[model samples]
Target chain A: MTGLLVGLGRASLSVFERLGRGHLFLLRILLGLAALVRRPRLLVVQVWSVGVQSLLIIVVAGTFVGMVLALQGYNTLITFGAEQSLGVVVAKSLLRELGPVIAALLFAGRAGSALTAEIGFMKATEQLSAMEMMAVDPVRRIVVPRFVAGIISMPLLAAIFTAVGVLGGHFCGVGLLGVDEGAFWSQMQAKVTLLDDVVNGVMIKSLAFGFVVSWIAVFEGYDAVPTSEGVSAATTRTVVHSSLAILALDFILTGLMFN
Target chain B: MKDPRLMEISVGAFVAIGLAALLLLALKVANLAQFSPPPGYEVKAYFDNIGGLQVRSPVKMGGVLVGRITNIGFDSKRFQAVVTLRISQIYNSIPADTAANIYTAGLLGEQYVGLEAGGDDTSLVAGDEITITQSAVVLEKIIQEFLYSKTTKSASPGS
Candidate 1:
């Protein structure tokens, strides 16, 4: 009984310690952001790296998901003699579930991992230490801009994904399958509510996911030991941890927003 | 020759694309675009049972949609669902005795208010009440009734 209680206490203590660390980390990143106001180039470069570079990948993946949904949804809906509602099927699935989750997964793999690797590599090369030696805080100079860029990029990536996906669905459902174009668009407009699906479900969900993925990424890179293997491990851990955090947060946010 | 100004263009383009995507989603998927009905008039309908009826249900005339249900409410005193319809000015010929019925859009999909034209020469106008309205047929209730009737018929056919 005493052992179980001790184990429980240790778990709670570790969780509390992690919470405290994350809070302090966020505070420092905010300070770093404040320091970057004079030098806007740093922020712009990070946005270019984090956001602009990821566009093609997001678009291609979104299109594939949309086309696949049309093919699959058509088959199932036809079984129920509801092929007309293919628009609803594709639109609801993308906005409510796939858009945020898949976008975040891709973001984690692409930009999030890249961030971890970049930061970790700097730590491994003693560049961060050198900056410290020069009386320049590495966190303020390096971490904050990347964090902000990730936050900004996520919702944009998700929006582009959803838009391209819709077009893909339109191509497959209307052009290929010969479903009425009017029905495809009109039914979607009639049924899908703006505030419920887009604002709360897709946009809000993706933003939260963005914060989690980037937070995990930047933290992993920052905390890594100064070694080549440690840097590589940090990159790997960034991908794995960010992916998991995104999915878990997706579930929680979906429940809160939809229900 | 990678100009630093190249980034400015890309960033601007990115913001433009983001806003455009948002506009498209809002217009197409979320149905926020004002497909503005060219001026309209309000009409009310009362139903004994609304079933799954909701606001924004399309008001169809002669199998063609002419307006939308703008509001839905429960009238406790009347013990009925009060539905407010907004009919397009383009479809102003609806008679005074026209009947409104709640219908599923695609057999089993979303519900809408479908209006059936009546024989009265007098046309309906703003703030008019559609006295003749039929509520939606609940499928489960219909199935249950069918099953119950079958059991009873098999048990007591001679009567």
Candidate 2:
């Protein structure tokens, strides 16, 4: 009994310690933002690596998801004689929930894992230490730009995801399914609101998810044990932890905003 | 080193497309234009029971949207519901004796106020009261009335 209690205590203590360290690391990166502003080119380069590279996957996934939503929604709505409302169902779901959440998940897997591996490899090669030896703040020179880039890329990607998804739904709903084209767009416009559903649901949710995912990726990379195996482990952890954070944060955010 | 110009151009393009997507989401998918309240006049109507009628419900004249319900209040003295509608400026010629009736859009759908115009030369202006207003039809009340009428008919036949 004593051994079990000791083990549990140690586990909880480590978790809290990691949480505290993560917050501090995030604060340091945020403080480093001022220095990053002086060299906007650094930000542009990171955005290219993170945002532009991830575009193809976001669009592909968005189209498939939107098409699937329309297909499934049509089947259900038809039973109740509401197939005409397919646009409402599809647009609302994509905008309010699936768009931000799925985009964040994909971002974690794509750009997030890349961030961890790149940073982790730098630590493994003593590149970070060498920067410190050269009188450079590694956090400002390295982590801040990527972190800010992640933050900027997420909302844009999510917005693109939602737009592509809406078109995909339209193709499936109006084109393939033969629902009236006019009704499809009109019902969607009448039902979904700008501030409540679009801004609050999609944009704000993506922004929050962006902050969480980027913070996790950078922190995990910075905290990784400096070895080849350690870099791999950190990369895996970045994807897993970031995915879990996106889902859990989505739930909390939905409760706060929608309620 | 890779071409910096190419990298910057790609990033700029990415940002541009993303902003365009957001703009499309706002204007095309969601109701952005409807957020701005149009130039309109307000009119009040009293009903016995509002039912599921809510503020922002469309007030239609002959199935055409002319205004929207702005506020729903309870009149303590008359024990009635007071619904205020903001009619657009273009629809300023609505007859003074227009009767407002609550109607459901579709089966198990949202309810709105439907106005039937009367043959009056004078038109309703801001703050004018619409006295001829019908309350929303509650499903349970309708079912109960139907059942009561059936029982009464059966009893009369027996007598």
Candidate 3:
């Protein structure tokens, strides 16, 4: 029992140490600089991969979630004869919570995993080493572009998800469930405010998620041990760690901002 | 290697365009006029419960959104929720004796403030407090009350 306790303590300490590393600060600065220096083609590929590629998944998931929210919210309100407030329920839930967080998670799973794998592969192939020998900073060259791309794409994708999700909720709640269309829209217009909550929430979540994803990918790639096996392990760790971190950070930020 | 410089420029342009598009879309959706309530018409209502009542929750009259709940807070003195509503320009003529009720939508939907206009010809001006108010009737409490009443009735045979 004592041995097990010791092992657990050591393991937990290592995890916290990894999380508290200062490299992430440097990585953020490097990413910003690279984004400033690099031009068109890098940007296009980043946009295409991060925004365009992830579009379909975001739309599909957002729509369904919206539908479910409407169905559940509408049913609950109906018993109390407040069916008119369905619009406010749908709008506030989507804009404040679901839209940004869900979209970011989807982006992390899709683009974020791919980024980790690609960078890990380059490390395995010694391309990163070659860049180092050539005096080209690999962090700036490879990691920064992806980082900048993520930050830019996340908010745009979140907005798209929100708009589509609201429409989907409308279709389910009003079209299928027999809610008055005018009442739905009017309540939505009355309830959703831009500056105080919705806009601020979306922006903060997207940017933080982008930063977390890129940092994880680069950290895993840089520290990958061996050649092939190490790279593979790093790739897996990148995906899992970044995804979990996004969720954990989301809760913390939400408490700080909303509660 | 692909030119990092070129990539950066393209990404910057892409982000700029995307932000612009989102701005346009937000403008179209928000329709600025909707945010502006009438120049001189505010009212306060009290409720026992205001479930799911967000800041922008509508104040409706016969299913029309005439105003919005601008603020909600607990009134320690009254031991009720004090809701401040701003009526739009077109809805500036609400009668002084209007009754406000805390209402819910479908089961589990949102809660809102519903207004019933009185027959009085005097229009309510800004800073007026709504005297007639109905607190929300929670479904769970009603169910519990009904069950207790049924048990009590069954136990007593004579009365």
* Candidate 1: residue pairs that collide: none
Quality of candidate 2's docking, in CAPRI categories?
A: high
Write model 1 residue lDDT over A1-259, tens digit each, in one string.
9999999999999879866887789888876788888878888888888888988899999999999999899988888987888998899999999988999999999999999999998998989999999999999888988898898888988988998998999899898987788888888888788889889877898889888888888988887767889988889989998888888888888788878
Q: Residues A53-131, candidate 3: write the lDDT tens digits.
A: 7878987998998899899999998897887878778877777778878888888788877777787888888898899
Clash counts per candidate, in order, are: 0, 0, 32
Write the residue-wise lDDT of candidate 1 on B21-43 in tens digits.
87888887887865455589999
Q: Which regions of candidate 2 deviate over 4 angstroms?
A: A1-6
lDDT of 1 at A17: 83
Better of 1 and 2 by lDDT: 2
Number of the candidate with higher TM-score, 1 or 3: 1
Best by DockQ: 2
- Each candidate's TM vs. the true structure? 0.91, 0.97, 0.70
On TM-score, the candidate that comes out on top is: 2
TM-score of 1: 0.91
DockQ of each: 0.68, 0.90, 0.19
lDDT of 2 by residue, A68-170 (tens): 9999999999898888889999999999999999999999999999999999999999999999999999999999999999999999999999999999999
CA shift at A49, candidate 2, in angstroms?
1.0
True contacts kept of 2: 0.98
